[model samples]
Target: MPDRPATASLDNPRYYLQNFRSVLRWVAGHHADLLTPQEAVRLAQFEALPEGSQALLVRMVMRKGDQFRASKLSYTEIGPTTVALQPLVSQGWVDPQPTLSLAQLFALLTRAELVRSLQAPLAQAGLKRNATKQAMLQSLAEASPQPAPLAHWCPGIADTVVALRSGPLFQRLQLMFFGNLHQDWSEFVLAELGHQRYEKLSLLPQSRAFQHRSEVDSYLQMQACRDRLDAGEAPAAVWPDISRSQAPSPWLESRRARLLFSLGRMAERAGDSTLARQAYRLSTHREARLRRLRLEEQQGEAEQVFCLVSDALKAPANAAEQLGLVRIRQRLGRRLGKTLERLPRPAAIPEIELVLPRQDSVEMAVVAHLSRADAPVRYVENRLLNGLFALLCWPALYAPLPGAFFHPFHAAPADLDRDDFIARRQTLFDDCLATLGRDDYRECIYQRWEQKQGIACPFIHWPTLTRELLDLALGCIPAQDLQACFERLLADLRAHRSGLPDLIQFWPASSRYRLVEVKGPGDRLQDHQRRWLEFCLSRGIDVALCHVRWQASPTAECET
Candidate 1:
């Protein structure tokens, strides 16, 4: 017989082949539904292995289940048909499952193999609790009718058997184990397994079922109170009264405090000072114990409560309350300021100009129409013109821009003296207005402003030949262009600087950067403008867009 081939040795080939066949049979019988067609082929290949290797294959598959259960995978639904078979390859006990994607199977299999090895050390190190051990064994037995031979070698096997004999730990272990196993099986398995276990356990007649009716009612009431408060209603008023006929319990007192706080705020809104004070005082007294408890237990809530008390005291009619409120407010403000100071300051504004086209002709017409009815059109013009001038005079009103002259433009005069200067300024303003009205000019200005300066002009209004002209002229523009224009205007003023004292220093060397963009409500930046804004951002420029509503009201005194 050729001395019996070396490949067929009993210790190797025959042993491995027999084990492999057994594993194949076990898998087909227990997990046939879980295996894909491709996986089924791979499983068959393992079945063809020598008996010695077959035992290793069975161990590998079993390890995969143990690993899945260990990692809390049992919490998720796992179908029997989709059982991953790659754990065997990871153990070096079997060749890689050839019919399945190697990468997909490697992770799961590797985890299982590693966990199996770790389990021995973990148990020996006393990391595996007796209850955990029992739960694991019970899950194993339930999963497979006959435990694999490898189970005998597990370090905690004896301890697990002892635990299964009795006690609360045993029951808990059984619940956790089966809970996880059912999760591995299917979604319906959890409910089914739970029901079966309940019936079996119920036979003991000593097991107590949990009741949640009172707990659920408490939660519902709390939620309803929160909902009422969120909707800006007084929760105490909206919630059913539970305090009048009965002495207040801790719960009722807490509810009362919350209600009182809500009522205080409502009273304050309604301008009922006496009622508001009464409500706030009631809340403070009712929550006194809660305040003390919070001080001892919750630092955050204690501080908040202190703040609320202080605020109430500050406005309190009595001297004692006022003093207390003042001190508390000051302390809180100091702490808040200290914390705020630790935060980083905003970035400095970069030198840039945002330009938008002038569109004030129609607006100017409306102003002119409204002013035309008035005896003095010049007064209306002067009011509008002065408003623009006042804005330029205050550089701080518009930020990020270093000065008001950040945009290259000149303001219309409060009053023009020389016909020559007036004509020149009027012409310049008209040219800008006319150009802004044209689509091409408007689009170009819009794109240029957005890209270079990051601004967009949506619509135009005209105040007059003067006010509208000044507004358009003073609006956003490229910084370099603004500088050039300022220089030219200054030169022009110096040459004709004699007659119009009002136009003195048209280009103030003290000029600071100021940029502002106005849009109607709901208006947003245009696409090209948005792109330009990105460009300005990349270059680090300061810009702001504001929605402005223009209204005529009694004018205030001028700053200068």
Candidate 2:
């Protein structure tokens, strides 16, 4: 709860121990109500232990597995491993005589150690000392040994295997602190090494991810099922656990929707349409409704799909979904012999044909062919526009609203992808966008670009969006155009973030520019690219699709 102690400094060899202590304190302070009685007791016990014992235990918890060879568990800061492990052994936090299967035992010991330890078994099975680890294990397969203490397996070996009993408890605390299992202690190392730096945010008590213990348990449950699913388990096999793990929190509900959507897709791939439909119906994921409608349509249920699409059209989830729903509705209307109003056709995106000498990439070749002294072409792709938007709207994006950010390490808001993300900070975003009307907008963008350089952001790409590119864009592109593009981005951050034109040609002298989407000889426009191009066309922005053909060279006659 207080500032980190001097012992926690990065220069200290025991920094990891300090990090573990910080996490324990943070979890206890913010999530006190959510902690179980047993967890609270364990935390108190862990704190009461000798510092060396605590460090050793933290080291094992941070390691790859629960089991460790006593010989392998040496640390300079913790002094002698034996002395540090004594408190752990006394407190029953570690099992000195851990039961390990043959596989686990083989993983912990070297081949030479295996040969020396099982000499009698090897001799009985006609295996020599030169035998491989697998061969030695298989030779004793018929006389299958039950899992027992390391002593039972290798009594002659002086080393002991210590299994940390509190690994799972420590893991729960970690999950509560980070809000997910994917991010681990390595984040601290990254920050300390300056490979990654985060915005320092003032975290309030309620800024935490989970409001109740049930949400934490639900997240853990969903994560376990997700792990099982990722491990190639069938959807049907893991469905029951996921089904029972639903949470009322919107964030957890979003996770549930994603998991269910994945399960639905897996079920569909497995030829279980019934299960797939059920999963889709249960999910709140945006694509789930569209997928369900398409599946129903395939089954000759046009009327049902028609009704759903018509209702969905009244209040579409986002632009992408709205586009899909319109198409579905139009198709169903025609099939049902009902007349429906049609939307106006989008203006055609102008196309250009170029035959250029091959280069590293199609985009590079196109840039080479199109670029001139006065008009310079840069492969901005999605980076330039997204980067500019990120720079201008950095304040709104990183606003310390409740539940938006809980920790200092966040690259962006936690609710960036949430539905109400824009509405919650509409005024702030409007103010940011309002600057575009004045000359100060350029300075504002440049200031943030310089200030927040290399800080992790969802949209800003520091490596590619250089100052020259920013200056060229600001000089050439009109203020209203930037505002339009930024507004479209805010419309559906998830959908409109990508699929931008690959190259931008700047005519700085005349204050003009053109966006080009490059395509190779056989390539065609994709849906998202077309969507972006169409959006540009509707906004009166100059955009062109360039089709590149490789220029042929004359071959030498019959040298062979």
Candidate 3:
């Protein structure tokens, strides 16, 4: 027998087949203990097949559907289609005769093919030859015909359809390989074709995503629940599948928390406050407790709200949650007629009022108006801080810790946004951030900027991160201030990653900078943006809120 190809190359005619085999080998090697008896037997059976048969099976599996017409099964490298398929049929991997519903038949057959096959039915229904495929399907749907073999549906239509019986097995193997269903066979092809490049990490045998078989099962179950919720199923209907007991894994627990939070939001939208409260109470997601407090306050449960808010304020998850808890407590205090200690109000954001000629983008107008010879204003928004953090912390972010780097094609860690993301790599991140205290931090940033340029990162926008901007940022923004901003980002990556000021004005000569948030006519600061502005102001950062008004056009003025 030929040795399995060491690498997948697009130049090979059977690159997809090679990729599929690689996945099987990878899963068998890494997840052998997790495989069930049936899966083990199936894997052995698949290996026992001839090369052509294996290639044929893989080709069918990679395609969208399980069923395919023999005429469509034309791969030159796999030799004769029937010759390749015979072994698959003998091994029970492909069903030569399988039942398919009318819907399935409709999907398989073209409109013209349908008319030719179902001529009698169409004629009986008095439908025109020019009738749409949809019309024909709708007309036939009323008859409720039983599912039957393709031959029965389209008798002697010069075609044979075969169904691959092991799509679910392939799916399970893929989940084991990729650690998620969102990525599929294309990742291998993309990597081979040089469309995307990933960091090379030294993976140990124990570094696989799933330690126990139950994690795989739980992931699939959670995925199904999410799918049902997305398909417009009621929260109450999907609630039973959400396991009340927590999983031992932090990543799995995070998935459950996020799903519960989603279900709670859905319930709240549907006006099921009780169900929403139940979901929120059970969820360990950062926003869940705050949402629950808001709901309770709405339902006239002020005392309960106060108790929960007080407990939460003692050890709030992050700044956003802490800020929310304080507001809830203040409202409850007002209602309960009790004086409470208040958090010192953040200094008001300095405002700049601009009345300018109407422009398409208010931000650009502000940028044009604020630009000067020595002091240049650019629309940096959230990019500058995010890019710098990503560059400085590349090592920490891409650390090949177990359960983080499952595959070779990952753009970012699987748990980058998870609650324990920072906790897992605290030491590495601390080492990376410690540079901010020293002078070599600028060189470290520049080195990463050059070496890892254009590499896929969650935070870095390579297209917009120019050398001039980098120089300006390094010179103007103090290391202490960058450290503070980065610390806040690490504190709550998901919540604090966005809502930065729209623009930054830099005085490179003086090594000074000011971050500006722009608001157009009738626009107000969003809660998240306000939170960010408050954070900046509290840290003694130079930031301002700019409100712009559009001057009336000549035609508008004449009409008035």
Whose lDDT is higher: candidate 1's or candidate 3's?
A: 3
Clashes of each: 35, 0, 0
Candidate 2 residue-wise lDDT, 79-171, digit = tens: 999999999999999998899988789889999988888888889999878889898878777788788788999999999999999977877
RMSD of each: 30.4, 4.0, 3.5
Ranking of models by lDDT = 3, 2, 1
TM-score of each: 0.16, 0.89, 0.90
Comparing 2 with 3 on lDDT, the higher-scoring candidate is 3
TM-score comparison, 1 vs 2, better candidate: 2
Q: How does residue 40 of candidate 1 score in lDDT?
A: 66
Residue range 424-477, candidate 3, lDDT tens digits: 999998999999989899999999899988777889888789999999999999
125-150 in candidate 1: lDDT tens per residue?
44543335434444433433332222
Estimate every model's Cα lDDT from 0 to 1.
Answer: 0.33, 0.86, 0.88
Cα deviation in Å at residue 297, candidate 3?
Answer: 2.8
Q: Distance from true position, residue 533, model 2, in Å?
A: 0.6
Q: List candidate 3 stretches off by more than 4 Å.
A: 1-7, 115-145, 332-344, 357-360, 554-560
In candidate 3, clashing pairs total 0
